[model samples]
Target chain A: MTEPAVTGTGTGTRAAPKLVLDNVVKDFSTRRRKTVRAIDGIDIEVGDGEIVCLVGASGCGKSTLLNIVAGLEQPTSGRVTIDGETIVGPGPDRGMVFQSYSLYPWRTVSENVAFGLECIGMPRKDRAERVQELLGIIGLARFADNHPKELSGGMRQRVAIARALAPEPDILLLDEPFGALDAQTRRAMQEFLLLVWQRTRATILFVTHDIEEAILLATRIYVLSSHPGRIVEEITVPFGANRGPSVLRDPRFLDLRDEIQELLTTQVER
Target chain B: MTDTSLQPVPGSGPRTRSGTGASNLGDDPAAPWRRTAKSGSRGRKQGVLFRLRDEIPLRHRILLAVIGVASIFVFWLLAATLWSSGNVLVPTPLAAWKAFIDYWQSGELSTDLWASLVRVAEGYALSMAVGIVLGVAIGSFRSVEAFWESPIGFLRYIPATALTPLFLLWLGIDETPKIALIIAGTVFYNILMIADVTRAVPRELITASYTLGASRLRVLTRVILPHSLPGIIDVGRINLAAAWLMLVVAELLAAQNGLGYRLVQLQRFHQVDGMFAILLIFAVIGICSDLALRGLRTLVAPWARP
Candidate 1:
């Protein structure tokens, strides 16, 4: 499989496109049965191991698109595929970490991280080892026995990420995962997410309304426009990979931040 | 909400020239909100007011409760025996105590207590089993709810006491009828409460589990059941009261060896002091059982603390 030609300043997308959204459309009916088009015809493919972000305003339905990909919601039209196979529903191949962290309040940190492993029927010994490794990486090993209520918002979200990755899915879907955190914690979590991505190499599809965040983490950005939401622009981030928080100070990062900001502000005719 | 620990307390240190540090504070837009970060307000939690209830020491609380109970007892003794000397209805605390000792010496108190406790155990256990199974099933499945919701709701409105004649006619004056009465009283109340809790289990947690590759059954077991655990205990705790309330109704008609029977028997003899003694016993039993349930709740769901 060849990489799609870089229409933006992005580097070459290599190997297979692990996730694909083809001609996706979603409609919602109100209490009065009035159909509101949440998403319009949209086609995008995530290259193998690529970090792709769908950035848009509130009504743009970026979350709806992510939900469809996660198999939590079915698209009104078109299909979503991962590794050339169509997804019918949520499976272990796609692990999702929601904005709410969604860590089981009843489970301790280690148990929450081991949840998917438990669901997939991993042996208890192996699951324990895997959970321990994940806890150490996310810096929650010391607090592994603590329940979600005992954890701060950021710590709970780190557990959420670790829990999502515990299943070792081919793709990780994060729906504004750091949205609830304070600014400092959100920044740290972004850095932590990159570290997790580097270790796991799972293809990520992160959805966010924050442009700066999209620029900081995403390899390629899909800017979605609202009012019958559709992709308005696709940007190839030139800052490349193996980045740290220092990359935020780069001129290219500033330019890209401004560029996405401009696209979001102005109405571009389709 | 301010981080008052970082703020210097007024008069704690020699005052510095105000304009000297004005330029440094000028750069921060949020510095104005920190003005309330006085030392006096340090470590104050948001949304909670300082109350006499909060500041009262625990030992004092216990002492105050004991004093309150003694005061009531003294008042009863004064009004019943001293002030109204010949009023038989007004049993003094000493007379009630004497009646309690008389019943205990006869061993009838222990027998009644044992009988009442056995019925509670049998009927309450049955209710718990049926309530949890049907509550979780009904709450998780729309079809199950559709099937059972209306009937359960309809039965809930009809007081368990109203079914006395039916229970007596069907099962006769036996332990089975009394147990059935208690079961009927507690089950549906528990079902509706537990089902509400199951339904209120967050949609997001369920979806998160599904994406983690959990089968429907796994989600039900690992997520739904455990999440609803505290609620189940809460239902049991609440329904314990309902269970005891029905205890009297169940024993009212033909209960030979229960606390309710002892109460009715004492009343027939116009032994007002004995009735008061039995009422005190009921209070103790009810309170002790409620405390036991609360202990069980703490043991079952260690994380759900107030």
Candidate 2:
């Protein structure tokens, strides 16, 4: 198949990528004294302001890869760098959203969002203002004083996103954030995420198993094979920044979706 | 009667309204069959009296509690009156009431109550402070856990009552020994319980804090401490009973005018009514403190479910 012409989206260019993972590998030691390889030799570059989705099946170590980049886990051999500096541990430069909404149960929506800012010693007034602004962007201003338990699952996930975004991290790492939501809510959240992306233009590294979700939200999609996960193919989504839900019916979207489905199924068979 | 019997069963018409949107029973051919089959047995009215895992109204709940307490009181009254033949071990309700009134009128009740409350407050407050510090340390860090684990394990097994004499020998016969005994009894349990609560804090929260650029101290103070606060308060509530137990033990051994010391005096005089009166005071105090701690938990951590 011929490659589609490069659009004006920021993902097309790779020069001085914002975040780079160089030959990253992770291995876990089992109780049987055997080393189990999780992901091997992953080299990925997410350009600044790009939405890159790592698509894979369960047990494919896609989350492990994201965690390595987030500095929540260390790679066994390779290195991850952002802005040319190697990441030794978790820092405020990268924000993370987990599948489980990790909002502090004790904190209100506003307090949860302000947590990171509080950690960085932002003054109380500034923290409140920043939290209010982010809540407005996420459209949860009315829920500022409400605890997480009071919000719906979708709303809580939005608050999680807002919290991660509060410190203004350079990169946003999301690990199957909408996996727990119902189908209808998931679609709504996908749109909300795109809206967030369009407004902030923050670089995002999203990991998910759903090919359709990948195609809908990603500027570039990296297909990963399971059982010692390795990158199998890198496909640039043909849609531009103006892409919408209508793209689901677009011929090109269907073709790319089928291609990824075929790639993943063949990987499982192998 | 015949027409009504032949008509579609009363409540089963709405029961078969499935999500398939077959709202008109006449339009669907299978609806009558479903209604007839379901109406025979499944259409019986369910009683609200014994709902499965359902909440009763507050007034009903209070009424039930009153009945329960009244039944216990009736049983006690019967036992005291009917079994009054041999030794008169159980005091009559009126006798116990009179004894309580006499003790109150003498003003000795206030003195003894004040003495016991002061000792408990001092020792329990000291233990809680120490326990929380050590528990947070032990729970948060491996080195601290290793340092304190074995010593605490060994010490907790030795009964605090057993150590009463030792405490007396070491700290002398003043309030020091009594306070020391209460601490010895409750602090170890508090430490272990609070440590477990701290350790139970979700790892994801700590990791999330780190990714948000929280230092270890900040994570401890901001995340773990607040998250564990409700659980710690729970631990305090449960262990307060132990503190009361130790208070009685400490006062029984030594010195002046505590409830436990008064109980010993009453026992010597065969004043079982006074003993029962003192026991009632203990019960009241226990219930009040438990309720207070529960209120405090709700106040500090409103996010936590009751």
Candidate 3:
């Protein structure tokens, strides 16, 4: 899984990153009026064409952080800026995928993929062309007319991905997009996501509890510690977009995985 | 050298003829009438009645139900003539059937059935129109729910029949009172049921749409409405029976040309057989309406099937 040469984000290139989550903090109030800080002091920068993953255990509020970036939930403090502009609310610039798939059951696969386009009032002929193009990318062209309920869990997620990509967002915020899938499907989805990222080169911030998943997909992995979640470390992966699942067998991958595993246990003990 | 086939595309993506393995099951719902037309004379060879007998429990159940129905008729025939005075109390099944045929021949049955059906159609349509609008509005918005929910919940406890006399006074002895009574009977229940349906729509779907760049109005119209529609249709079918039940009660109060009116008039003249005929007619109408609603549910929302 090696390429002849790489030009972007190598030792040479130092271009401005696409997304900056600067000292983001989020607070939540329980039913009993107890104030709880879900996320504290999270700082992340995602380069253009990069996939960044937030890996944490339960109660670390990785999903909450992802939601804030999506603008579904606002951060209690600090600002999230993309390309030097602060984000106030959800816009077409950032696309999102959820673990639940959340593909509209009433719509067919293509119809669901066309939803974002339809929201922006894209013309019928252009929308149809884009829909066909997306269905092909997801390998669901034959099942274009099939509703979400008729599809398997993996197929549904693929449709969700296509719909998110339809608007061609600058950043994709995925909240455990493959969390609900079985191990086999999750692996396939991870590989498929890499290919999609190579093709689109959109910056992405993904959240997951699985450490191995973060290693497989992310350009850089952010290890989040639990109990008032904060980024423990940022490990820049040496792997490139040319790599696939074959990279899992590499000695470097095992070393990184073990290193992160040790840090996780040690932090949890403290 | 860089792999050329796996090339970068800044504009329109290259057509790689996706090799992604996705199963395709195209629309293939069975249509019986098409087979009949296509087969022509051959259709008789595999007649609808006999062709699927091996697959269906209906053929065997039909004979069992026929025997059960015949036995009831025989018991009625025997019991009605058991004693000289018993005939006055229990009318023979033959006499009831004969009464039906007589009323049908005299055109009285048609007029009564038509009147009741018209009233039900008008009143039921009105309830559905208002109930759906108010239900979706109230269920989706907290402010709307707060304004209307308390009164709707309170009104559901009062039986619509109890308001028949009030409706009669307000509307006089016309079809208006009859229709209004049926509307009053079913509307409140429908409002609550349809509201429950709207509330039941999953919150994840809404958030997903919002993140997909849909506006607030788009979420309501495209997401919430369509997601809750199948359940709303189911609620409507359930409430249609309530509408029919109310029609009978309302007709008993003032309707001069309905089946309920015919039943009352028949009893006044001690025509027990004709009264029994009207009851059987009501049962038949109820069964037909239920079948119709089930068919409509399938046609409108095949995706809702388990």
User: Given the true complex, what DockQ would model 2 score?
Assistant: 0.67
The candidate with the higher DockQ, 1 or 2, is 2
Q: How would you encode candidate 3's per-residue C-alpha lDDT over A1-270 as one tens digit per residue?
A: 113233465422433678999999999999999999999989988877678889888888999998888888899999899889988777767889989868887778989999999888899999999899878878889999999898999999999998998988888889899999999999999999888877666678899888888888888899989889999998988787678899899898899899889878877887
| Per-residue lDDT of model 1, residues B1-306, tens digit only | 255664556434322334454333223354555443333333435443345455566877788899999998888887786645444577888888999999999999999999999999899999999999999998899999999989987888998889989999999998999889999898998888888989988999999999999999999998999889988988887888788878888897888889899989988888888999988998898788878888987888888767
Pitting candidate 1 against candidate 2, the one with the higher lDDT is 2
Instruction: Give the candidates in order of lDDT, highest first.
Output: 2, 1, 3
List the candidates ranked by TM-score, beginning with the highest.
2, 1, 3
What tier of docking accuracy does candidate 2 attain? medium
What value does the lDDT take at residue A228 in candidate 2?
97
What lDDT would each prediction earn against the true structure?
Answer: 0.85, 0.89, 0.83
Which tens-of-lDDT digit does each residue in B150-231 have in candidate 3?
A: 8987888998889988998999999998889989999998888888999998888888888878888888999999888888
Summarize candidate 2's per-residue lDDT along B17-135 as a digit string, tens digits: 66554343333565555442332233334465577897878888899999999998899899988876567788888899999999999999999999999999999999999999999
Give the chain B TM-score for each candidate.
0.77, 0.82, 0.74
Q: Runs in model 1 with CA error above 4 Å? A: A1-11, A267-270, B1-71, B82-88
Among these predictions, the greatest lDDT belongs to 2
Supply the DockQ value of model 3.
0.44
Model 1: lDDT equals: 0.85
Ten residues in a row with the worst lDDT in model 3 chain B? B19-28
